[model samples]
Target: MQVGIFQTQEAAADYAAAHIIDVVGGATDPVLGVATGSTPLKLYERLRAAHAAGTFTLAGKKAIALDEYVGIADDHPERYRNVLRTELVGEDKTGLTDELLFTPDSSAPDPQAAAARYDEQIRALGGATIQILGIGSDGHIAFNEPGGSLVSRTHVDVLTAQTRTDNARFFDGDLAKVPTESISQGLGTIMEAKEIILLAFGEGKARAVKELVEGAVSAKWPATVLQMHPKVTVLVDEAAASQLELADFYTERWNARH
Candidate 1:
């Protein structure tokens, strides 16, 4: 595990994008595990810019969303699928073609079977070459909320109140409209990624980032599972690194690498 503390969110995003570009350049049929939410918005924007500038190409790369709401239509604006379509897969965005993008069927007649199929698809694609993540304010990863099983696989997850309330912003401040359940890749599944990058910004994420970086590897802070992964990189702005006791050490490490 490596921690990088950048002066600004844009700087962190740039670092992440550059790293991703390098990984994609060397991998064969890379499949990216992508996360949604505001924390990763800058990274996606940077990736788009890199693609537009000819600094990198998204062609031939595949991607899978980390989770999807169980009860939402695939076309719903707030649905994870549509969100990825608009933000990461659109022709004007990352240029990830529809056929190469995989997401769970939120409205499937048999969601469990669909989840299992999605897991199989991931395995068949050679697992994710890189997994992008955003830690929740409460330290959750994907929809694996606090107290979630550490070894679980793809399955239905009941959204915690905090998660639902946090996601309410995407639903126009209507927490009631947010789906109560979601299908998410499990911790064990995410651990299959060859590389993992977790992005965090703002003071709002300080505690979670601190706990993830400094706390014990416990299920209470689901993101802490990254501590056990062989190749996990954590990038955070100064605000998000505020609560880390080893903030200076991380900064020194990043500076040395640059």
Candidate 2:
């Protein structure tokens, strides 16, 4: 588990984006697993810029969301699908629409069946080619809150109160509207990714980031599971890396590798 600290969001995005570009640059039809929320917004923008520069095209690439809120319409501003469309697909002008983005249809009559098929799509990637992650303030990855099984797969999971509160930043400060339930890819599903680039910023994520990279490996800090993966590149800003004891050392070594 390597942690690299950037001076600002732009720096972090550039570092993370370059890695993602490298992956897409080398693949025929890369299967990318993406996450939503404020942290990844910048990285998504960088990807848009890269695509505009004639770097790579998503014409054949596949995308999957890390989680989806239940009971929300696909057009809802806070919906993960909407977020991805605005931040990633539409922004890139890649002509990648719903056909390319595979997310569970919450309004579908058979949500369980949708989840089952979602698993099959992810498996078709032979696991995710390169997954982008954003760690929650409580260390939750996607909506898989603490105490959830580590080797779990795509399924409905209850969101933690902290996660709901933290996610309120996206819903115009209305905590009550944040969904209590979400269909999320499990820790096991995330671990299946061939590589992962996790981006985090702000002081709010300090403790969770600390626990994720430095503390004991446990399901309580769900993102801690990344430590077990072979190809994980974590990009964090100074504020978010504050609580990580070896943060500076990690960043110094990372500078050498990059």
Candidate 3:
């Protein structure tokens, strides 16, 4: 596990964007496992901007979402499908194409079948060339909430009221309308990625970031599983590094490593 603390959001976004482009630029079929949340918005914009300038490119790319609301229609404005389309794949005339996408739609016969098929589809990219993540206040990755089996596979997960509320803003101020369940890639699956880059922003994420990076590894904080991965990068702005006890040390150490 490696961590980098930056003084500004721009610095953090540039670091993440460069790593993602480096990973995608070299892969034959880069399978990007995407997340939907406020933290990654800037990173997406940076990637789009870089692609336009020819600083990086994702030609012939493919991807699968980290998760999606299980009971929601794909047309739902807040679904991960829609978020990915708007954020990451939105650049007009880019090499990123619709043909390279796969999502969990309501057409699945059941949540289990949908999950199984999703896993098979993702296995095609040498298993996620790069995966972008957002940490839960409770430290979840994807929707693999705490206490879930680390080796679990894709399946429907009942959302805690907190999870629902956290995601409700995208639904235009309707927490109650947020889906109660989600189809997510299991912790075990996400850990299979060749490279993982988890981003957290804002002061609100400080504690969660501290716990996942410097605290004990525990299922109760699902993101703690990152410590066990062969390759992982935790990128954050100063606001999100506020509670880290060795915040100064991390800054020095990360600068040296990078």
* Most TM-score-accurate candidate: 1
Clash list (residue pairs), candidate 3: none
Clashes of 2: 0
lDDT digits (tens) for residues 93-165 of candidate 2 = 6545667898877776776676777777788767778999999888888888999898888888788888888
Task: Estimate TM-scores for all models.
Answer: 0.97, 0.95, 0.94
The candidate that wins on lDDT is 1
- The 10-residue segment with the lowest total lDDT in model 2: 89-98
Per-residue lDDT tens digits of candidate 3, residues 225-256?
88889999999988898999988887788878
- Shift of residue 187 alpha carbon in model 3, Å: 0.3
Stretches > 4 Å off in candidate 1: none
> Is candidate 1 or 3 superior in TM-score?
1
Model 3 deviation from the true structure expressed as Cα RMSD, one decimal place: 1.6
Clashes of 3: 0
